[model samples]
Target chain A: MDKTTGIRKRAWLLMFVVVALVTATCGNGADDTTTTAAAAATTTTAAAAATTTTAAAAATTAAESMTVAKVAVLVPEEPTDFGWNQQGVEGAVAAADAAGIESEVAGGLGYDAPTATLRQLAETSDLMFAHASGFATAAKEVAVETGVPVVVWGSPDDREPGLAAFVSTSAQEGGYLAGILAARTTQTGQLGIVISADDFNWTRHSGGFIEGACSIDPTIDIELVQIGEGGYADVEGGARVTAILIAGGADVILGNGDGSSFGMIRAVETEDPPAGADKVWFIDVIGDKTSIDTENILLSSILWDFQPTYLQAIRDVEAGTFGDVNYDLNLATNGIALLRTENISDELWAEIQTARDGIVDGSISVPAADTRAAAEQLLGCGA
Target chain B: MFDETLITAVLVGAIAASVPLMLAGIGELISERAGVLNIGLEGMMLMGAYGGFWVAIETESIWLGFIGGAAAGALASLVMVFLCVRWGLDQIVVGIGVLLGAEGLTSLLDAATFADTRPRIGITARLDIPGLSDIPVAGRVVFGEPYMVYVTLLAVAVAGWVLWKTPWGLAIRATGERPEAVDAAGVNVVVVRSLAVLSAGVFGGLGGAYLSLVSAGNFIPMMTGGRGFMAIVLAMLARGRPLLLAAGALLFGFATAGTTALQLVGVEVRPEIVNSLPFAVVLAALVLLGRNEFLPSALALPYVRGER
Candidate 1:
């Protein structure tokens, strides 16, 4: 409008250009990428001139999304955990194979805060699956910084649309099934739920169990206890708590602790039966550890398969719906199911199948509970 | 609900939870008294757990496993001995490095060997006292425990006597309180401190072995679960008293057991409150009962012979 105003505006525009150039050059590990990306963008814009506006937009979108060549999976523990870590590594490999892409497993990274490893993996990976809930924050950080898509666990809200996605499991439905089985098979009618942590997944599953057990028989002695805040590897705590529960009229135990489940199994193996109970039985969760159960105490496990979940995540990336859509592995999709162990008899499995059918058909409604009180209420207990 | 079986269960569980903390605390207290604050107790315990579990499974003898566990702990502590005592490195830093190294090493070794099979060892056989084991509810819980339990209890008495009544104990106390003075007196402060740390490693290892063989019947990675840190805290609170440290450990154990009991009995408490109950009690004790007077004067300070 005015001569001085025009001069000021021109100066500001020059400053902005300078700042952009400085940023493109100064950003750590992003300088070369920035230059290459800018050249590609110029080429794309030129190509778009001859195409329809909608087709141009679609092409631009396609160009922006990475052609995922290799996916890397990071876990807090070794894959030999026989539970979460093992399942996660196996799932990542399976998904990579299905998508005809390469997969790298970086497991046993520990539970401390992460970012260094995520950055290292991002150097070679198009997609990274951070297999622990604790790794979500670090994964999101790396995703935003590197423009590499990442899949994290437990936190759907942390999804950054195109950058990060999350996977949730139908743990409650599987938990409900476990409860019904426990109630049906229990000779003493005293079932105990042992959790290593006060995790949302544990609560969801434990609550489902309480609901199912109560449905079978109201006023059933359902003892619930947690080892610690997150004692995922507190094997002694698992054994100690389970032994106490067994002593306190609990013949059937629903145990949910990753590495700690072995302790529960140990207690079942060694401890004598309580006065009213004939034998001790352990129902587990996540990946099946039945192969390692030398004693036939492992009754069942509400399996949480991440293979389908990871594969779906890969497909969503290809479809350009990456973080825009959330994924849930549920009984409805056969993602979560009860592992039929030899300890579970034919008659029991038949009844379980009937329940499974009911759940699938919507005849049985398994309520979602992410809290202890809510789980208690679901079990018909006045919390 | 408060029947004999339930009472017995709670008490027995409490004992099981307390033993490792107690043994580790006592060991830490001895080290703290000698001026070397070993922060790698968690790592040492882990190594012991692995070593103990492996030996016990291989030998089918739980007693030998305890020995293996203790030896492993002592071996792990040699790093602390070399770095802190011999080379005059920062005690806290060395301790942390030891912990990280031990955790990584044990986990790597464990995964390499037994991660697939997940083998479990038989429980250590329990021993029952003649008349004392016949009491109503606390009978088996108090007197009829595994041989290691009695040994641990005896260890407390022996450690107390050694700490206050013996020349070596006096030397350890003097080294912690006044390393310069002890060195001047030709007591060999480094030797005393090294031995104290080694003792701590043995006890920490034994505690870890007890966890794998007697408590859980198997070893799991990072299964020590910061109990070694808790032991260090208990040591600080106990103020050079082995029996008091054991009491503090038991108090922590009881609080943890109470949380479980309350949950099992369907007590209507907030999940956050229930989860934090044990830690809350420990903190409350630390605030209320943990007097800071008797801490070793030169706890983590590396003694530099003639330096002021």
Candidate 2:
């Protein structure tokens, strides 16, 4: 019996050694990974801290450095596209130039590409602006990896530590403006707003436009068409849908899709005018007719100035106080503006100007409609 | 809303869309005909797009971008050749590896290259054949195109003629059909197959270059957007005949253009559903084509000397 017990004990001891060997191997492997992660985190923190210090020192020693601050702007589309992406590019370039910073612009890069670009800029540039919400993931990853403060425009994610801050314009307000334009311009009493499906940003714009138009003229018939569920690269679908709306007698059209907007513009341009009647008008989003060079067709545009917000976030980054929260740029802050042009009659222009002044003076407080309740309150609608 | 102009638009759009697919399909056909199946065409095309765009942006020359794209594709294919030929790795797994690797590399490189520099090329100006351009719908469809469209057509014609008429083509067919016989005939089958795969890489690269340098005039990650796979499907549909490949490519292009046109005309159909029609058609075609036994007998078999 003792011999059998001894053998069992030996077997147990052997099993323990085997288990210990396996445990040691796994623990060592995990330790290696954790160490590398920790090292990366430390390096990133150091780099970020260094950047902050350098910025502060540069401010103090402005005369000594004599080197202009450099800002890098990354966009998801060509800067000259005359749209939302273009506006960001233009604003960033103008802002950087005005601030005496050397500005560089990159376009046609997706989320992953911008991250690497941001990292490279973080090493040298005073500020880096990732100019699209699509770049949020890449920007966040790179910012954390490189410990660089990245300022993203149109991004909703405010949780990352290295993310300097987001500069968001009221897309809802822009939508409301589009609605007002459509409502005022439509003679057929039928207007249509074509949105590129259910993006939160597009939804806000579409919802706000619908609300604002309904508020102005409750009897005006409004048709809301959502084109394609997948994200906004479908220009053909946009064109097709716009044609349908035109067939249905929508005299004025508003579109919030990026490249898809070009299709809508094309549809209207090619549409045959009703005999002896005025041609249909379009309200452009993010840019005006000046960018696209089409004035007769486009009535006006809703524009955003991202410079003030971008600069503010850069300042925070330099101060080493980058926070996680949405920085609201509303009509009151001169962040949003409606383009003024001769095409708009003096009477209509005066009315829009009055509304603008009211918004600025807080008399007509356009309730910030980020939520469903806010949207309802702003539009004074029961939904 | 559906008129002669719409029909013309569909025709033009189809021809335009066929350029990328034709280039990639012809390349893939050459590779497959040489007994090497490369599923890395997608990744290679993406790398080529970015490389071409970057080169064009830097040099302000579209031709330079095209060359850069070709080089990038060649480099990418070299990786595949090394794995499959040198290491004797499984071609499918190696292809998947190559696809993933190329994607990651292109994404990283694209960011590094384009960061803070938005470089764009002007759209290819339409070339109008004075007499032909006056023919209304047909004129717009046939005469109104950039030089690249003509090149794509010329490429298909030349590839078809070469594959059927040349001694090199015979050797390639021999290599793909019965490698043992070709090896006994004193031809280095491996070398011929590698060259075919490399040529395919070049064509795939050019296709990608065309996308960024001519078609879109800019680069985006994954911008090849499965055109490479679509090209492979086209090749399968055409059964490796270049002329038939061109027709199949045009069909796909039409489907794509039709879907887009229909959406533009406000057909109230869900965009998602409409967008998927082209892929569905391709799948259906594959099912129908699968019954035909036209594939090269030795296709996908690694040529090992002295193995029974």
Candidate 3:
């Protein structure tokens, strides 16, 4: 009977430990709530402190006052890949340099790594720039915890409340420009597009390119290929797919993948030139390709400059005027531009310029591929 | 698109994917044949990849970067050897520790060295053999390859020959099968086992170099993507035979290539689902093969001079 009683007591103790563990796990959500509340309290206290200081300073009207704020820029990949992430790094550096603000830059923070790094930086920085769509979730979570504003780059979507704003170049306009270039350059009447994947972003660009090209010549054939599994990282896969397209008589090719575009460029570089022909033309995305000298290749590029948008956001943050709406930097805002060199014919240049003017003057509004309505209406395909 | 060219594409993808696995598998085969199971193959490959990529980026030469990667793998292996062989630690535990340490070290060092640095080495163009490259799909699949691919094939051939047709191979196998007998024959069992482990490290490191320098041309954290462990699986499936391992590696490569190809044909499968195919296939193979028991006798056993 005594042994049975001892066993029952031990069993009760084991149950208590299990309950404690379960409670601890459940308490994590409660702790998060408390942290947010604490952050809100701190924010209120800081506002009150600022109000008192301003009131006190009103008595000493002759005193000059200055405030210094620290800003941080975070990137998801290397800054020198001559592609996606590089643009963000360059933009942040240029903006910070111009404003003469003390800033720190962190790059190559993988999917979840950005949240931890951003949280650590939040303790010191007055504002943070989260520079990738993949980094948006973590940036939003950290912004809520720290009660600080975060400015993210990429097409605006359903973002958290603290995401002050989003800045992005109009991808559809860029695609339209690429289509105009491809239509003019194609000798076989068929232009090929090798994208990184079949994501909404790539589909928008490809759809716009196709529509723009067909607008110029209804019978023009446009073959769209995607390195579906590679996800913008597979250069070899891109090269192989590009080679196959070129072999299938695609005279002009346009690449929409960031780093994977290098593969397409290489494929064009290695292809044997026709007798008496100088080179084949290829269109570039994200950054300028006019500088890369390859015989008759690298004809034009669509350049997305984040400098103006990023600087404006920083200025707004410093002035304490951050807001929730996205700062759309479309072609109308001079955020996206079509860059062509003397290598392109003057006649073709005039044609592209007409479309550019039309976009800027609000005569043309390029639809994005994010919404079902836009995809169905613009792409003529149901989601 | 579904004509004879499709066959060529499949073959080419298989060969390309098999190169890294072949290198790492042959190394693991030798290491396991010597009775030291090194599960840190993946981590070691990652280290080599980052090291090779950084060196090549700084030196602007792929060859130097390849050497740097091999050295890095060897250094990582040396740590495993010290823990398992010298300190008499548990082989599996030591390997797990090494794997974790190498992974952490690679990520930390990659962040420190290559962060915000855009470093790329020009792809080594295909080597065209005069008449051989003109023959249908076989020509494009086999003849049109980078120099590293040729080296991998040669390494596999050489490894097979060395393991099955050499006296040193016999001694090494004997040490694994019966360390007492080999020690009684006056062979320095420690030296042979250490050399086997180090050679395995070199092969794994080369696999990493191929990934960082040749494949991606830039270092991404954890970029080996479990290829090292996959190589070990290939080694096991082949029963330590280099030629069979090559075949196994090609099977994995084809699975990956096919998954990508299917999506390109507008098969509308979620990418995450496709990515999981190769791993799932490997797990199934392991379970099925485990039931049949086609493993080396002394595969995971560590050698002790006088123990049973």
Candidate 4:
């Protein structure tokens, strides 16, 4: 081969090596890109973009003078998951619609460092919500880089004075209610908590569930199995762990995750009921799957409504009070509530309502366990 | 806490989980035994999964779904054959490109089609070996499984025999170890390498299909979850031996299910430690058993007719 040809081949090989290394280190999933149609179809103009930048820079409290024009959300997976991603995207959309603003959604970004996507989204957005906990550090970095106000999850300490904020949820309240429902309905006196990861939302929800189940029957057998440290998209692991929990005599299962929860639902729909139970019931969190529950095994879900939180964030950004305090979504604000399906009996539903009122009225206290060890202690299975 | 029923369930799950790894590993073993390093196996598997899921949804036939999956994988491999094998392009670059393309296409297709409804397939039927399935815990654990499991085991045996006991097998081995010698011996190195890559695609496709059709009973974006990479590692650890590849895959499967088993029985260890158990086992196995194993000398190098 000629000298030029040989040099070209070596250069090409080096380029390939770099691409392979990046892809490997970034981990597997769909590539991170934007849906331009989704972002561009909205009625956003240069005036709105200018107002957002001025408000972010001035940090002024003139809420009436500054108008929030456009907001965007970044999710690690597709919003169609009917779980965390979907809820976050829907919340952004709803908040934008409520404030008469445009909304942009950048989904399927995977778990890679979304510096590029975030920078692209910030060019047109007045505010951004980094939906996944995995995206927190990247979101903070990009917020400082692009001068766009960003919201993240479970990192209150990382919030900047004006650039970044965080959203926290009292999901355990909803979990406690679901636990009461499960404890009342379970035939085998066993409950299963299948966590796709040791996420903050999942850990707190599990702790509340164990406490609530025990409130009804202190001797209830509650088994918690984590699929993996980061099995959020591990559908097979979700199914396998759920099946094992079922075999261990858990009739009512509380499942947490994004796409992996679908696998848990599949396991419930397919696996035969344990020895004493005639049917298996699944309680989900963050999003409702009643529409897609083909086999009707879905009993309820600890629904999370981020619309109010997102809307308030937009308002705070306009008022120059962004990042002053973390946004909290709880049962009292109707941000966190339990779904009541037809599968639940009227009498049981009434009892659940009373419990809900008690929780809202300060007559009940739900334990908040934000870690696996804390959750296990609540379950009386601490190491 | 460790009852017969729980033990039986764990064993069954381990076998079910191992099937995909074994299928993909054995296929990769064949490809590596030839002169090609199939880095795009993950991409091929993802394409197969998408094809299998789309076909299964449209046709409502599991058999056709599997066929569609295999065809899709082969179709993806044809890209590698044309680029790396025929044109003698850089295999690593082409493989990574194929993987990225597959991920984007599958995710986009899934979002457009099933993101709204999220339709799920019904329960897959398990085949019970008539007499053996009735023999208590061992019977159910060993004899009852999806039919694909048996087919995969048979494939492992066939792969082993073909790689060791056939004239064509020697050609494949020789091509990997010394492509120039194979070309001089009138074996048509290009054709042999192409066939090996195509086989890898077919096997990888079936593995992906088994995952969507039997294991998860539905397709999620990126649902293969790095199993393709795991298969590649197993294939490397096996050193071109199909039987050893199968064993390594099974070990991974058991280790995965065993983590859950340990947690289910209330083992007082940290989850981090329990989760790392599988990797520790694999590393230990590699250190002890794979110490002397070596990859083919000519693997991953594009063969040129007149070049050294």
Name the candidate that leads on TM-score: 4
Which tens-of-lDDT digit does each residue in B1-308 have in candidate 4? 88876776677667767888898888788999997899999988888888887888888988888888888888888999999999999999999988898888888888888888887776666676788965655676667666778889999999999999998889999999999999999999999999999988988888888778777767888888888877887888788889998888887777777778888766644546744554566677767766534778888999989987
Off by over 4 Å in 4: A1-65, A138-147, A158-163, A319-321, A381-383, B128-135, B180-186, B266-293, B305-308
The DockQ of each candidate is 0.47, 0.06, 0.19, 0.44
Error of 3 at A68 (Å): 7.8
TM per prediction: 0.85, 0.62, 0.79, 0.86
lDDT of 3 by residue, A239-328 (tens): 656655554456677777766776567666654332223455677776764544434478777667777777777776655455445675
lDDT of 3 at A50: 33
RMSD of candidates 1 onward, in order: 7.5, 10.3, 7.3, 7.6
Q: What is the lDDT of residue A137 in candidate 1?
A: 86
| lDDT of candidate 2 over B1-308, digit per residue (tens) | 56665566567667757788898888888888877788888877877777877888788877788888888887888877777755557888888888898888876776666533434454445677888865755785577666777878898998887788887777777877788888899888888788778877888888888777665556655656678887877776676789989998887677656654564454545545644655676677668777435667777778788883
Residue A289, candidate 4: C-alpha displacement in angstroms: 1.8
> In lDDT terms, which candidate is top?
4
lDDT of 4 by residue, A66-161 (tens): 456899999988888889999989988998999889999999887886878987887678789998887888886666555567899847787665
- Write candidate 3's Cα lDDT for B138-201 as tens digits: 8866777777888889999998888889977777777667667788999887777788888788
List the candidate 2 regions with Cα displacement exceeding 4 Å.
Answer: A1-169, A175-197, A203-229, A232-329, A338-383, B85-87, B268-294
Docking class of 1: acceptable
After TM-score superposition, the amount by which residue B206's alpha carbon in candidate 1 deviates from its true location, in angstroms, is: 1.4
TM-score (C-alpha) between model 3 and the true structure: 0.79
Interface RMSD, all candidates in order, equals 2.0, 6.5, 4.2, 1.7
Q: List the residue pairs that clash in candidate 4.
A: none
